[model samples]
Target: MSPSAIPPDDILLQVTPALPLPEVWDAIVRPEQLTRWLAPRVRLELREGGPFELFWDPEDPSQNSTQGCTLLRFRDQDEIAFTWKGPPAFDALMNRGTRLTEVQIRVAPCPEGIDVTLEH
Candidate 1:
């Protein structure tokens, strides 16, 4: 589907990882490691209706975080979904604070590889 076709309520980002489900999930979900690749610092409670925040700088520590976040769904190393309600950054300039409401991530284990789908 095209970017325009995705509802304003949902956005999807998919990635294929060469590692096992647990390994991939751990690396992606780990706050410290996630900052290195995805953002700067990630703080997640990994629970239903918990707060999930991502900071732009780890060293500064006073930066604004992506707030109003919550884990809506989770299935161990299989699937996860959360609410992403913070202001958008440079990449998502048009969507800033627009309630791109739900971010859904799915982990599919197949014979050849594992498909990681992230929806924001």
Candidate 2:
């Protein structure tokens, strides 16, 4: 099916980390930080429409270990949105093929620290 014809089904994630916005933004964009916390390996280009890929199992060295994704939007220390094409299991759960899904992350200052909201 064409991308435009795919129905939308998004997953949202939210968290309030006891850290500043800049730190949170760095953790999201920096490859080193992402490898430490999010994925086994991550490659990101800090620009709109840039190519991005995430390796969940770097040791596997196979297509199944990688997630072919992309960066769609970026706002310094505020928000970043990306396209996530995870494993086939995820696509099966979403009832779609290999169509990319949107994952948007927004950061805002809160009384405690920074509020990070991730919507996919």
Candidate 3:
């Protein structure tokens, strides 16, 4: 079956961090900084219209993190939704498409810290 056969759903990941909302956002979402903890390297054009790219391994930037890895949406110091593409078997079972089927991340403070949640 092709990835287009599956239905699309909004993936949400939330986590609570000790730091403030803006601080947490800077630490986790900022492209260059995110690599230190999250991925190896992230090039994010944070805007309503921008390209978001993440390279899991500095050695190889062409391959997606998995299969459907892409950035869908991002809210400053609040939320980030991205396509999760990895593990062929798992990707077929969960993520199989030009678009991402799963998002792995943290959400902090509806108004203010970090609330982290993962959705697929």
Candidate 4:
């Protein structure tokens, strides 16, 4: 099945990280590998509807973590999308609010290495 459609947003970033497409894909899918670069604490289940939690604070789980979000789309080696919650500082405004944002990461092989497009 095709990956879920990510609604258009003004926030967009495109980068060509110096890593092979497969490696880049692994970096996003493998929590163990992602912890080395992405976030200090990573808990991600790489399947459609799987849970994903990324903690930035090593000292506190409730401080800066995406605690109860789940994957909306999971296309192996191609793309992924998950619900997103803001940090604790925005707890009252964003986290406690009715709607939650979504983050999508798309990857492809490129001359430089892996071409990445992240939409939030």
Tens digit of per-residue lDDT, candidate 2, span 20-111:
78788899899999898888888789898786778887776344434557788998988888886656555665425656667788899999
The positional error of residue 8 in candidate 1, measured at the CA in angstroms, is 8.4
In angstroms, the error of model 2 at 59 is 4.0
Model 3 root-mean-square deviation: 6.6
TM-score of each: 0.71, 0.80, 0.62, 0.82
Give the Å error, residue 102, model 3. Answer: 4.0
Clash pairs detected, candidate 2: 11-120
Cα deviation at 55, candidate 1, in Å, is: 0.7
Q: Provide the lowest-lDDT 10-residue window in model 4.
A: 1-10
Ranking by lDDT: 4, 2, 1, 3
In order, what lDDT does every prediction score?
A: 0.69, 0.76, 0.59, 0.81
What value of lDDT does candidate 3 attain over all alpha carbons? 0.59
Off by over 4 Å in 3: 1-14, 62-69, 87-90, 104-106, 110-113
- Give lDDT tens digits, candidate 4, residues 18-75: 9877888888889998899878998888777888888888688787888888899988
Backbone clash count, each prediction separately: 2, 1, 16, 0
| Candidate number with greatest lDDT | 4
- Candidate 1 — which residues are off by over 4 angstroms? 1-10, 58-64, 86-100
TM-score of 3: 0.62
